[model samples]
Target chain A: MIEIQTDPLLYRVQKPEVRERFEALKQRPVVLSVQNLYKTFESQTGTVTALKDVSFDVYRREFMCVIGPSGCGKSTLIRILAGLESSSDGKVLLDGNPVTGPGPDRGMVFQSYTLFPWLTVKQNVMFGPRMSGKRGTSAESEARQWIDLVGLSKFENSYPHQLSGGMKQRVAIARALANRPRILLMDEPFGALDAQTRCQMQSYLLQIWRNLDITILFITHDLDEAAFLADRILVLKANPGEVNEIIEVPVPRPRSAAQFITPEFIATKYRIDQLIHPDQGSPEDALPFPRMTPQGDDVE
Target chain B: MLTMFSFSLPLLAWCAVSYLPFLWHPDVELQISADREGVTTVYTPGDRVSEEFFPEFEAAVRTQNEEVSPFMSLDKPVEAGSESSVRRSNKKVLRHLAPLLVSNGWLTEEQTKDDAAIYVAWKEIATGARLPEQPALTEENLEIVRKNWALMSRYSDSYNADNFVSRPLLSLVPQGRPANPDYLPAPHRVLISGFKEFTKPAEAERPSMWQRVGHSMRIVFGGFLLAALVGVPIGVICGTYSFFSKLIEPFTDFFRYMPAPTFSTLLVVIFLANDAPKMALVFIGTIFQLILVVANTTRRLELPLLEAAQTLGANQAQLLTRVVIPGILPNLYNDLRILLGWAWTWLVIAELVGVKSGLTEFIETQGRWRNFDSVYPVIILIGLIGFFTDQILSFIRGFIFPWTSEGPAITSTPVAKVLLFVPRWFKSAVDERIPYQPESTSPNKA
Candidate 1:
């Protein structure tokens, strides 16, 4: 039971009358709500606040991409949501139930090749269902379906080491999807791939999401990647990372490389780049936070 | 020619030492006499019984039975050059001792009577007191004469009395010559003639070398199987759970540092002195060290693999069975191969403890008998078996874990080709766990 919103944008950007009329339609129900999240990292030098008062909501079947510069805690937020790491405070709710830890309900694909090196491509995909106590012909078929969906039917018997990096990531995706999770969390899944392979992977991932009707929360540092793939792009500012903006993509879906040169795509990419780098063209531009602060100045 | 010389250097050294005395005094023959009691004396040809060394034999007779002691009750004194008097008294002594020496098979009656007179005559020539009509004793005959003296001295009924002498061999010549029955035989003789014993049935008192080797192999296999079965699971559990590791590590570590042989007393208290103690020795020798090695290998498992398994919804039991065990298997197998070799070092120590019947005991007994003809081959056999076992383990490891850096050895031989089939069997074994899925009728369907 998903409620569809006629107005895809969360916040209105057009005329007041038109925006009000569009908002009168049904709004999509939230699939995941992350609220008041904070994460702090302690080290020998001092305590570093990685994420502070971060909050976001992803709707059902929504393709949400989180973009940030290095050290912005975008990866940390997704990891906390995946339950691989714990949040210092606040909760991540999926289907209105709090995620306590990593479970079958949430599947993750890491940037590294996380496919089981000891198992074959088919065996890696089958690992989830087999561990969940589903076996025999049914589990085999489910694993095979995902492997084929990832365009790896021919390499089913090959080990992870034998496959290329992109193929390994594809197997990882299939392995995550074999559990039939409600949400797929990808942490820079295509970041390790070459340019051509990354583009292909982005398109294939889009196709999979459309066909399976699965919600996805992708973490990336690439501006064009977020602009082209996300229904909404969440941009974060660094140094105790905070949410700067969430821009809704107005471009039509079923997108491809032809849309890469479109003005709308270029405008969204520029806007995200500006938000991440507020003082884009100024020579005096530096980190918003002072490089060296006085002793005992707002340590938290 | 150079290769032959390189191999013959030791043989040449032995020859030079053996012939050195003859080079010094070509006319004389030196006879060395030895026996089970370890009494030894060197006798030269033409030396009389009074001049030769049999003082212990004389003392033994005087203490054992005074009435029969010729040295105690001689009618004529045996002066150095008094041939007639010495011969007369020696003949009487020979007559009195012939029946006893004959009963013990030490000397024949003719040897005692005629040989005793000849020895007296040779004594005059040896000391330059008289000229012989013709030379009667040569190097070969002198050896027989020395043998006669050794037999007489050893078989004397009172030889074990306080008069006993412990004499090591006269090593003016190199040792280990077949001519000296007490010396170890040459290496070639051991490998050739010693191997002939395996072609026939074994005796009741001592089995053949092959049979002893079989027994040792069985014991090693039993101990290795038990250690692998018990140690591997404990190691896996210990590695998986930090608390279990903490509980088991202190004791295993402490015992590993202590000598494994020190446990023989406890083994004896728990089990009978038979094969149980022997097998327990081999087991105890390796199990503690193996547990530590395997536990370390498991602890060093890649963290990302475990995290991937967790994200894949693996329970604790599934994680252990599917991921952890397989992850550490290749390294564990390498650890096992090394430990099996270490177990061989303990094999001798283990078999030597109680009711010894293995190759080590065989070697020990043969060494005591001065039969290196049998002892050397058994040692070589143990080395050969250990070497081949290591090769087989390496091949099996390569076969099972092909993904590991230890790839199978490449060859075109028929045996290698047949061994290549072994991986198929391993694949089938694993196929039961992750069943093979056939290709879908349609290749690309989302």
Candidate 2:
């Protein structure tokens, strides 16, 4: 997925259907909070701190994007939230309780093609339910529904190895959704695709997320991606990694890459560019965006 | 290929040296000098020389030689006599010499009294004797004359064939009736070449050469057939279900490496009270090796393929019958390749102690006698039989693994394909699983 460098999981900020579905989806009544989280890896050279004192809050059905430099522990934070990994110090609360181990409640989409190479696309999508150890016929039927939803009905029997990278990831997303987890944790899921495939995947992801009111914790490295996909972006810094700032696009609901040329989109783009690289904030300055605070308030 | 050369080059060199003399000097040509006036050339005495002219060879050794001796007496002087009397004496020498010639392989079952004349005639010319028939040589007498010279030259100083323990004088008969012949040596040299061309042998003797080849053929054919018979069902069972595999695993694990001799010895001890102890030992030895093949191959039945069926919810029975067996068959045949090889080693070892009639026994007997001539041929026969059987097994592999040679493997991944197709012994074993089938896919019989 080429656009991985642009924005790992930030879905395309376009398509009127995504807006329509967003309005149509029934929001899950749940809240999430990251309280002073910290994560570190022990290596032969000693410990490398990946996250330090990172904190944030997400309301029911809110789309949150975690953005930072390469290897900045944005993944670590998302993994911690999904309970795929344990945080060294901190608590990630879902519905007011600390998250623990991976369960049916939160479905995760990894960056790799985890579609189980041996199984077909449809079977891959149905895996979560099947692993839940239900009957096979029913699983197949439910798998078909998701297959149709992802517009991959024709490829239901196509193996992951046979499908293109984007196709494989779409199957992964569908599988995550089929489980009907309250929260969707995407860990740079589009990072492996080629550029064109990444764009196409982003648009599809937006469409699906809109149709389903799943709370999404989308992680990425692309600043523009953070602006385009997130209702709110948690901008993080490397080295004792922390949330450096929060920025909002303030754009209207429906958007597209075509809107990227607009004066308002360009202005907001400048604000993020300045926040990430303030010294370079000069006559080249362009897009304007509102910087939000950790208090969840505007810097009035 | 490197390993093949590593194993074959030395053997090839040995064969080259062993047979090199045959290529350069097929007839064992020798030069004779009676008075040292000049050397007279001699060729081996056989119809083959008359049938196939050695024009260049004959011209090369064209010299003069003269001596008045016929048949050589190993340790005595040849007394001269009248032409007819000496000729009659030589003929009598051959007929009377039949038993001794038979012992030394110069005669055969069918040789009779009339045949001794041929030996005498050839012996006369071979000694550079002035034969009355050779005036002076008539085409008839000269032919017999040249042959006699060849026989004498065959035993010249180099061969020292006169060392036949004893000898006698010879006579040249010039006055015999030209119309009818009295006797001759048998048509050919029955002494064998380099001592390796011993006959096929009769049943009672079960000569060392025959025992090795015959015994190995039984095992190669029988062990192969038995392994196929044995490996199929068990391989399918163990391959299909990990449980049957698990159930048999402990025993196979314990016995697989127990040393075939030990296995046979133990079986013999336990089954000694039975009627046919040796037969029982062989059966036990074969069974143990076969189970090892089945269990080992079963444990590694191309996991990806089996997993495909398992994930499909194929019941254990279905897995066993359809996916496991069919998919693993090529592998089972491949196991037959290895199984037969191991079985042969075991068979030899089993026959070593318990049984006394197989090739190993032949070798043991010959070894005790220090008759390496008898022993080596058997060993060679064993090798030849082993080669042929391996080829048979491979021919079977080629059929069963038709996909291996022709198209993509049943599995898509190269690794999976290799794991599903190549025999374990041949495999580099880069992975944990081995791929083989136990069956007779040989186009020859099965």
- Candidate closest to the true structure, highest lDDT: 1
Candidate 1 docking classification: acceptable
Indicate the fraction of true inter-chain contacts that candidate 2 also forms: 0.00
Global lDDT for candidate 1? 0.71
Inter-residue clash pairs, candidate 1: none
**TM-score, cand. 2 vs. native:** 0.52
C-alpha RMSD over true interface residues, each candidate: 4.2, 17.6
- What DockQ class does candidate 2 belong to? incorrect
Misplaced by over 4 Å in model 2 are A1-31, A267-300, B1-109, B112-446
The lDDT of model 2 is: 0.57
Candidate 2 C-alpha lDDT tens digits along A38-101: 9999999999999999987776676778877766788778767766579999888888888876
TM-scores of all predicted structures: 0.69, 0.52
Which segments of model 1 are wrong by more than 4 Å? A1-26, A41-47, A249-252, A258-300, B1-81, B84-190, B197-200, B368-373, B402-405, B408-446
Instruction: For candidate 2, write residues B1-446 as lDDT tens digits.
Output: 99899869976665554445433233321111011123344222211232123444333323211133333433435454444554444444334333333433444646644453435534544465534321133343355445444444444422232332122232222111111111111112112421443455555655545445565456445644654576557655665567887787568667656555555566668766332444444445566567666666666655534433333334446556655565556666766676666556555655555556567776787678555445555566666666777887665464455434234433455655576676643555642243322232211121
Residue A132 CA displacement from its true place in model 2, Å: 1.9
lDDT of 1 by residue, B1-446 (tens): 99799758976765554445433222222122222123455332222232222445334333433322243222434345554443343334233333333433445656656544444433333344543223223343333334334434443323232332122111111111113222434456765855675565788987766788788988888888899899999988899899999999899999998888888878877887887888898899889998898899999988778877887888778888899998888888889999999888888888877677688887888789667677767777888899899988886665567566434343334676686678768887887887656665432233
